[model samples]
Target: MDARFLGIPELVEVPDVAVVVDVMRAFTVAAWAFAQGAERIVLAGSPDEALALKARHPGAVALKDGAPAPGFDAVNSPGRLRSVDLGGRTVVQKTTAGTVGALAVKEASLVLCAGFVVAEATARLLRTRGCDGVTFVVTGEDGQADEDLACAQYIARRAAGTETDPAGYLHRAGASRAAAELTQGVRQGVHPDDVALCLELDRFPFALVAAVEEGLMVLRPHAVPSPIEGPSPIDGRPL
Candidate 1:
């Protein structure tokens, strides 16, 4: 399989498999939400659309970043979501980068939203499905999102059967300006533990696959088959 990396969503050219990454928080939050038992997530292009979607599906939970929307249940923070039980509920999520990037790839045969939390699972799924090529979309605009870029690279390496130590990538991501903003409490609605939560590499066992259903981009967790030798090691140690 061949791997190609692209920065920003606008440059994507409808590749066979597209892995849209947002490591600072968006996709990380989605992965944690799924781990917390969320049934599915509907990605909205904007906060207003998220509210509208929530209104249409009365039981759905709406989430966004920064300021709180009128009817949103919560903002996009995996730290805060850690305690919420979302078993069997639909999440309507609108984010600045992640969700937008995932929705932007309208023509890819497979669209998977990813972060370090689901990187390995995503690569495993790609191999299992026999995808000959993949394009990793760094959702951060203008190639400025170092965290997202690191995640895309890590996933690409994993897909190519490279045994990598994710520590270096994690270090690069941790030093990014976005990470500083989150750690310094500059971004509202973000908890102190949000950064740590976002950096937990390969925390989830499934990949978040996106598809349009009834005019909404829906993300569902698809479990990848486990290796016979059990979970792979990270930096020569068990994950």
Candidate 2:
């Protein structure tokens, strides 16, 4: 299996499998929402589109970040989403980085939204599906985003049959400028617990796969066991 990494803007051509990562914290929020029992998530390119999707779907909830759209149900933060009951409800998500990056890769046959929360499951699913090649798309700043880059590298290492420890990569991401800004509470609408939530490695045992259905990028979780021997430990808890 071969793996290549690129930023969203660098994606001139995408491979069979595309793993788009947004660790701080779009994909993380999506993973948490799925863990909270969301039925499905629709990725929108803009806030207007997300609102429209929610309106069309009736029960769908819209989530977004930056310059709060009047119709959005809430901000895209895993910390805040943890308390909301999304059980069996569809989510319409429009983020500045994550969703846009996933939609940009129009050439990829398969698109997966990834973050630390679902990194291991994503790698295991890729292996199980016998994908010959994979592309990791870092969605922040066309690849300059440290947190996203670190996540892409971690997933790449795991997919390559390496028994890697996530601490090192997590540390790198934690020290990034984005993390620092979020830590200092400078980013508006981002919850204080969002950084910690986003950094939880392998917290979910499912891969969030995106497929183009009816001209929309719809994401759904697929369960996949860890590639490693035992359940991966997270914050003294077994996943």
- Tens digit per residue, CA lDDT, model 2, 1-239: 68887887788865678999999989999998887778889999888888889999978999997545588887888988999999889999988899989998855788888999999888887777777789889888778988888998998888877899889899989998879988887776788899999999888888888888888889888777554545332222221
Per-candidate RMSD, Å: 4.8, 4.4
Q: Candidate 1 regions off by >4 Å?
A: 9-12, 229-239
What TM-score number comes out for model 2? 0.92
lDDT agreement of model 1 with the native: 0.85
lDDT of each: 0.85, 0.85
Q: Encode model 1's per-residue lDDT on 1-239: one tens digit a residue.
A: 78877866356367778899998789999998887788889999988889889998868999998866689998899999989999889999999888878887856789999999998989888887778888888887655689998888888888888899999999998998889999998888899998888899888888889988887789988777577745432212211
Please give the range of 10 consecutive residues that has the lowest summed lDDT in model 1.
230-239
